[model samples]
Target: MHILKKGLVILFGSILLSIGINFFLVPFELLDGGIIGVGLIIKYLTGMKPGLAIIFLSIPIFALAWFYNKSYFYNSLFGMLFSSFVIDLLSFSRGYIQLQIPPVVSSVFGGIFVGLGIGIMLRYETSTGGTDLLAQFLSKIFKINVGIMIFIIDALVICLGGLLISKESFFLSSLTITVVALFTSLCTWNDERTKLKTS
Candidate 1:
């Protein structure tokens, strides 16, 4: 039952994340953060599939997780696989729905869904791997806040995307990342408070 619950959480979270990416962010050329953002940029540049890019790009991170953190590896492995798979499977959305709304609005909604998805996974004690795991490892070694590392990594990716894509993409992508970070933080705030009370 416990395992099943975890599986469901991963499935739902991945679906939400994919929806935000395909339906909102991708259509507008906006971006989230971390490796997911990188995958999108790869797709934007090379005509490659974002999901395929994600799966391929994730290899090194998961490899590191395998050696350094068995628990994180097992927790994130399936989430990563399913999320990538779903993102590819949902590619039909590229032509199915194209909204002519403002980029800022799309960025906000995109961030909400993406952040909510990730936050749920994290709250459930799992994640989609990628930079989140890398952040954890780096934080352990450097004694810096994982959140800060993640933000930096995200900013780098978005900046690169902007350079390669467009100034508008860069600016809107920055907004998307900010919104995602804010919502993700909100989702985990309760968890932090609970942990504090328990500790």
Candidate 2:
């Protein structure tokens, strides 16, 4: 029952995350950090599918996971696969999703949706993998907030994306990541507090 609930949460979260990417960010050429950012970069440069790009980029990391520990890989695989599929499906069928918000507004709202999506998945002990998994590990090791760690990693990816994209992307994407970090932190804090009380 718990597993089923978790799976549903991840599924719901993935839908919102994909919407944030396709409906809000993609039209603006804005990027989110991590594998999603990499996928967008690939999409911009090669016109390939971002979902496929994400899966391909994740392969090496997932393959490497098998040599050390399989638990993390198993935990992440479902969330990653489902999210990637949803992203591609939405991107392909994006004719239905139209929002003409300004770039900054899109970034802010997109970040909130994406952050909440990711936060819920992470709270459930699953994630879309790549930097998210790395952020989780680093958070445990460094005893820092997972959201802050994710923000640091995302900053690097966005900077790289800016070099490949544009100056406008560099600045606005920073705002996007900051809000992502802020909202993710808030969610994580709330989830942890709830857990502490329940436990």
Tens-digit per-residue lDDT, 1-199, candidate 1? 9999999999999998988898889888888789899999998888799888888899999999999889989999899888889888888866867777787898888888888888788778787889876876785577554455666788999999999999999998888887777766676667756765786
CA RMSD per model (angstroms): 1.9, 2.0
- Local accuracy of candidate 2 as per-residue lDDT tens digits, 8-34: 988988998898899888888899998
Best by TM-score: 2
Task: Tell me the lDDT of candidate 1.
Answer: 0.83
Q: How accurate locally, in lDDT, is each candidate?
A: 0.83, 0.87
Q: RMSD to the native, candidate 1?
A: 1.9
Q: What residue pairs are clashing in model 2?
A: none
